[model samples]
Target: MPYKPTVVLSAIEEHHSDGVFTHTTVSRARAAMVRAVQAIYPLYFETMSRPPIEVSDLMARDGEKVTVLVHRHNNLFRTPQLIAVEGRIITTAKATPLGLIIKGHRNRGIALAPTELVDAVPGWGETAISALRARCEAVRALLPRETAPLTAGAISAIPDDTADAASCTTVLLTSTQLPYEDPVHGCLWLVSDRTPGSGEDILNGVLLAPPTSSLVSEHGSIYAGQLPPYTAHLPTAAALTYAEALDLAGAINGKDPSRGYLSALARLDAQL
Candidate 1:
């Protein structure tokens, strides 16, 4: 007898429907079908490995406060396949009148934040869909998906209109680093941290006098969105130095270490 490929067993079954078939023939056919199914089943943890960004908010009705942050890790997912959008609203009690807060602190301090959504845009669902489709295609091309027949394309087919009614807007927060230079000048700033005295002290350079207005200033750094939790806004560089000084001197230092040395070197060069 000649050996035959496994798939031929199926054809044999079809031809020999009226004839007797051996158990071996049936078993071999079943095995071949199993192999074919396994080839396309797409086995991997690619789908489950995505960072889940889901929120569970708890606020009392008519007598509570809530602060939402758009970029906070709790409100963001790291997966590229999903879309993210951020939306914000301020709610205040008519009786006591405490406005809502939506905060994203550059510092480690708690930002009195307002609620925002990512990935789900309200009125701009079409735009969001377009963006996600383009993004998914890009992700598919550049990064190999662990699962073939990945449900990525299926996601794009999901209706964007449904996103509008979503309680919070969906924001798209990719795991990739944002692409841009720092908008705020790399200067030290004094921001409100809900402590008037502390805020004022930092602003007045009592805590740590930062660079001169010419060298560093806050032309467009502060935002109405950042009114609560009075914080002194300092540039990353300035903050590092201020933190170091505070750790050692317990105050902000304004004196430049290189000032006198640079002046002396310039004078010597002039004489030469």
Candidate 2:
């Protein structure tokens, strides 16, 4: 019933496997929201090919159960708009023993019937195919991404980056020791290639990583792979992609940009 909120909510739902509350600043999730609106509400809203500047304020106006709160180190950066379509978007392909699918994506795939099952249940494949076809037909009705005008309010909605930067207070009790958890710590990067607020293609990034030892950034880094200066406990400036950030964050650490930034803030808040 609700237009914009549904779109926004759907986009957030698409990427979340763990069913957690998502923030407005996540660009990847927001991009998915952009795509969700296009797919679901095509007639009223043109399936935008480009992302917009301010979907945040729109939700506040639109009738939806929206909540507001601020974290210590609040930021809403977006990852790229990859994987818009879910495993629900099915395709026919050959699956292999090596867990690879050929010709088509077999992500979250299903086989009509295994060889023995087809033999044991003669009409099973036909019945399964028929049902799947109907389901896919229903899916075809909804699917699509893109643009809206830039609003002045949207510009204002962006937090005062200068103030946030100025508030960077990393108290080093001992100058000889790096304050952050050694071997790995927090980081953020300014990826100009990404869409700012309304960008479907881009969002800025946050990271919790050790000094860049071996990880390589997708767009590379302003500091190559080394740690940036004066970033001991504050989010420092650099260039990196979500994947690259995650890589540097390592397999054990969490990879969420929003949560990552919050954690960075929480750590610094203790000293203050």
Candidate 3:
């Protein structure tokens, strides 16, 4: 069988009668959900754990008795090596009254059933998990070729203190805007591949430039949350770890090391 793409699906089902996705609330909720998927994916992939297929819901008529039903689906493995977990965050008073409940069914294999009723939007949880899964799929597709020895781009130097002393290096992530506040001095820089062509060649091109003095960089700006910048100029295998590649770009840029130098070192160390 062809290898299926590994995914981590998280869905949030909201039982909000209000019918409104509040900007502030949704943003914060989404962030939290993304964080959960990020934390869970690594664990799931590292240790293969597959839970039995189950379905349950908190019914308002139950009057605090949360009811859930689970049935093992045939051909379960068809869904990729991905984690598809979802939850309903009901803002209504009904969801809050029932708390969480677990019940076993005789029809199914008779495994311990578990369910929870939380006070939040279910869609937030679902979307966050889905986002992580989708991102993982995308990254897998974007895996760089291993044939080439990763190269660094020419490093550009920027003055530490601009004419106004409020000077800072403008870290650009390809075309994205990843503005770093303060960069470290005389340190390495890192960046991610945003443009077409080989990431190594692009990095090498940036590194070949004159040394930069600014302490700001924007390596992981495009995928800011997922991929962050790293310190450049460290002795690590090129094209190995994602963090290292990013840091290598920083070193090549060298336009603003003061800020990203230490980060690069840490990222490189993580590769070990």
Candidate 4:
């Protein structure tokens, strides 16, 4: 799959009948496959105990705003749709009033993203067969369908830089809609949370170390697919002092303890 493991799944399914389709199969294998790839590459999420966005499901939501993750959608250049060329080269594509302008590496070769299928020329075009189509067909002939869901992988071998950081894993005091650039964990952070609903009494807390807890900076903004909610753009402890964090959070919501979660984050502020 030249495009992406996920995108390759989409392309192969669109043209060839041999591909992953079963919900349970995809569900079981997705994290494992993702984790395998993640072992080689640094995955955004510290843990992935969830389902992935299927391309078939994405096709269902035709025009609505959906998070388009190309190679994880970690770094999108303003435009959601970028160019994926053959020959192991990935460039970019931006829509102009005229048409989609595709540019090669360093803007060396420029071309229009072809709307219709033709001889592929490192430009955007519909393809009946993906790079994985032949390999997929061969693999299907070799393996049993039952084995698809049986595949599994591990992240135990993957190095953890935060090995020394105390796993102050505590209550689910908060859950952010968008990810902040974690200083220690990189992008797409999932801070430890614990929420127990079995009893009436609830004890809630979160892991907040001054070194790895805060966002990259307060001046900068990050985008997943489109603009995240205003609340997602939170202040980082590195960018502001503890007093500033408390003041800003209090000023926003003005609630008792619910005045934006920044007051709690003030503990992580290394400045002042």
Candidate 2, residues 1-272, lDDT tens digits: the string is 31110011222223544679533433332333233222222111122332222223222232222111101111133221211111121122352211111112434432222110100101123343344333323322332112122233332433342332322111110011234522222233322222333422222333332222322222222321233222221112232334544454343244443333333323433322
- In model 4, pairs of residues that clash are none
Lowest lDDT 10-mer window, candidate 2?
A: 114-123
Write down the lDDT of every candidate, Cα atoms only: 0.23, 0.26, 0.28, 0.25
lDDT of 1 by residue, 153-269 (tens): 322332232232211111110111113621111122222121123232111111211121222221112222332221111111111222332322222122441232222112212
Query: How would you order the candidates by lDDT, starting with the best?
Result: 3, 2, 4, 1
Judged by TM-score, which candidate is best? 4
- Tally clashing residue pairs in candidate 3: 45
Highest lDDT model number: 3
Instruction: List the candidate 1 regions with Cα displacement exceeding 4 Å.
Output: 1-123, 145-272
Q: What's the lDDT for residue 44 in model 3? A: 34
lDDT of 1: 0.23
Count of clashing residue pairs in every prediction: 40, 11, 45, 0
Q: What is the C-alpha RMSD of each candidate to the true structure, in Å?
A: 28.3, 20.6, 18.8, 17.8
